[model samples]
Target: MTAFLLRKLGWAAATMLTVSILVYLALEVNVDDVAAKVLGQFSTGEQREAWLLANGYRDPLVLRYGRWLVAFLSGDWGLSSHFRAPVIEIIPARLGASLLLGACALLVMVPTALLLGVIAGMRPNSVMDRVVSVFAILSTSVPDFASAVLLSAIFVFWLGVLPGTSTMLTGFSLSELVLPVAVLALYSTGYLARITRTAMAEVMASHYVRTARLKGAGTFRIVFRHALRNALIVPATVVMMQVPWLLSGVIVVEVFFAYKGFGSLLYDAALNSDIYLIEACAMVSVVVVVLSQILSDLAYVWLNPRISLSGAERSAGVTDA
Candidate 1:
């Protein structure tokens, strides 16, 4: 376990470094271009140059990147030109909001998908299976923005029960979050359910499951012990893969709902070309992606009895032997 974690952390660091380099080069290559962006396109060349010089943007590229990296590591995540505040100061609340929204959506999506999928798989070609199949296709077909608008119209305009926007300006309001969460959950649930259903069906048809049936094992015991863990392996990885999608989807939903979250911050940064904030958002996003993958792998190790660090290492050693 310790060795596996160390290896995952190493790969995560390497991934973050690569993403940071690419994002920095892409967004920060020409100092004058960034200066013009930060200063506004209409600003005079002299004003832009002066602003660049004042902010130490004239430094060599390598030295500047090194400085920026050190400062980022030490928590001095440069000022956001768009917000006129430090990037570090701005990211926490926005990150928290995105996390909360994502957690709620997953809380709704995971169990629902897993349950619907397992039920469908247990009786392939039955009415329940047909229902789950149709539901998956329909849900996965709709885009997040479209669903967001549709739900808003239904809940906000027609019924007049839910808020149209999730701004939550005064404080965090569950009522305001309902539409946004619903949109995210509804959009993601289908794709995951399909994957789960396939895995469950395959597992149910496996030799061991048939053997269990012949042995007259209790249905509950057979499913919980002989099938569920193996069935969940694929969906666990898919769920982690969904993390990036969910985060990216937040950009559209957050903007539509006027929610002040990480996704909105990323959108605003890109819209205004707020270089520091963009870099911060990019790196932070990669961090989240890599970390989620690590957690998924840990879950993988648990769900898959055949896979383990020490066992795999010993197997490799025996292979060499």
Candidate 2:
């Protein structure tokens, strides 16, 4: 596991470097002449050139990238053009809110998805199975933005039971997060439930499940202790993959609910053409995605001993000797 973690960390560093390059190039395409933009039409051409040169804008692209990379490594993520604050400082404040929202959404999604999946898989052709299948299909069909709007109308407008917008601070209660969390949870539950159901169904049909049943094991014990544990392996991987997806894809949901999360911050940065903030956001997102993939791979090894001994050994640092 130590060797495996080190390998993953190395890959993560490489991935971040690539992501930084891409983000830098993307931001470069946009107008980065902050001096020109801020100085305006009244400034003469020579004055603008002088200002740009003084700020090191005259440097080569490679030099600029090297400088940015060095600064980023040292915890200075550059200054935001719009907010006029360091990217590092602005990001962490919003990241906390995003993490809180993601946690709440996962809390609501995981158990509900697992329960529905297990029940459906236990009796494949039953009415409950059909109902769950239908719901899963419907849940995945609508996009998150539409769901957010529909939820807002029903829960906030019609029922007035939850706040339409969330003011998520350090001291904010969970009630402030309920509506946004529910929207995100409901949007993701269908996909996870379907994946779980499929995995569980396959496990239920295995020979060991039949043997356990024939040995007079109770249905709950046979399902939960044996089949469900193995069935959860795939779904758990899917759940881990959702971390990056939620982190980035929650932009629309966050915008709709006026929730101040990393997603919302990214959106604002893009709209305002804040290159520094955008780069920071993109880098953070890429890091999250790569780390999530690494975690999912490790989970696959941990869940299935056979896999750990076989294919996982090659890349996961598990030696045959």
RMSD of each: 3.9, 3.8
Candidate 1 local lDDT, 1-321, one digit each (tens): 788889879989999988888887998889989888777779998898889888778999998888778888999888898899999999999999999999999999999999999988887888998999999999989999999889988999999999888898888799998998999999679888888889999999999999999999987898998998899887887787789998899999999999999999999998888988988888899999988877777766677768786554343334324
Model 1 stretches astray by more than 4 angstroms: 41-43, 310-321
Question: Candidate 2: global Cα-lDDT?
Answer: 0.81
What would the per-residue lDDT of candidate 2 be over residues 30-93, giving only the tens digit for each residue?
Answer: 3245555545546788888887677677788888778778988899887886788888999997
- Quality of model 1 by C-alpha lDDT: 0.87
Instruction: Score each candidate by Cα lDDT.
Output: 0.87, 0.81
For candidate 1, report its TM-score.
Answer: 0.92
**TM-score of each model, in listed order:** 0.92, 0.91
CA lDDT, candidate 1, residue 152: 88
